[model samples]
Target: MGKVKKTRKNTYNYNVDRKKLRRRAKKKSAPRIQCDEIRNAWNRSKSLAGNMAEMGLVADPNKSLPIRERTVIGEPSKVRKPYVLEGLKAAASLPSKQTMGISSDMIMYVRHMVENYGEDYKAMARDEQNYYQDTPKQIMRKVNLYKHHHTKEYQTLLASRTKQ
Candidate 1:
């Protein structure tokens, strides 16, 4: 006489667990993106973009830099975020007609900062509004303070991944 062996049936139907299975499959196939890798990617890609811009390889400086005007004109003394001030400075150098950063890299520099930095453009705008509303010199002071932090705090922050 021969003995018969029985196989166990599948407990989870393919349809019933399809979502979880898909998630598990995704997890197995794709690895997580680490913070350092992201920062490094930013470091690499941003400079490359700037270089491309500097070379005149890329068209439309506005497209590359894309600084949205966030500052509102205040009556008198007020706050002015350095980021906005920087944008204004770079913009001032732009050709009166259209082109930007004729002989220098100010446009590229500001573009890189806006693109790679941690703070949101919206936040910069809000700060500019508040600073401008307070006093005429507020924006300049804010810009100076922000620039001063570049020597100490900003370096540490830049070393880490910047999340918006």
Candidate 2:
């Protein structure tokens, strides 16, 4: 072997002296000029006025004029209601009779089927309750309430159907 070239073990900044590297770093990171300092510099410099104009800041001291009068339109005062009161007001405004009618119809339909089917009504009612998304007790209560209110009409209808 003639002459072997020396290779660096740590290639990262190996050629640069540590002191020279630190000095270069200090020069590069000299201290950032703040907004106030930049503004003052821009105000003093005539050449920097164009650059400040692009940024639309208070760049020039002579050109900057304070607003004499400001027009502020007052917003309407809003009345804040409690969540419970708001919910109640919304509920009160809704057409609740329609939903009540639908629930009544479901109960009546189940009751009518129970009356027509007789002893086997429980099994049919179970399936009907599942379709109506109600429990057996709820369905029974509704059916019983319907029967109690329209006892005469219901009895007459049943009697008429049986006779036929």
Clashes (backbone N, CA, C under 3 Å), per candidate, total 13, 0
Find the candidate with the highest TM-score and give its number: 2
In model 2, the number of clashes is 0
The CA lDDT at 50 in model 1 is 45
Off by over 4 Å in 2: 1-104, 119-121, 128-130, 160-164
Q: RMSD (Cα, Å) of candidate 1?
A: 25.2
Candidate 2: tens digits of C-alpha lDDT, residues 1-164 = 78998997956767779998898898775544454424333423344444344334334454455355432222112212233234446766877565333356665675565566542445555664456756556666766666676777667656765775
lDDT of 1 by residue, 1-164 (tens): 88788999868565576888799999886555453323223323345444333333333445544478543223113322224344546766776775322222432332344345444544444443343343324433443455463445445555553543
lDDT of each: 0.44, 0.53
TM-score of 2: 0.28
TM-score of each: 0.18, 0.28
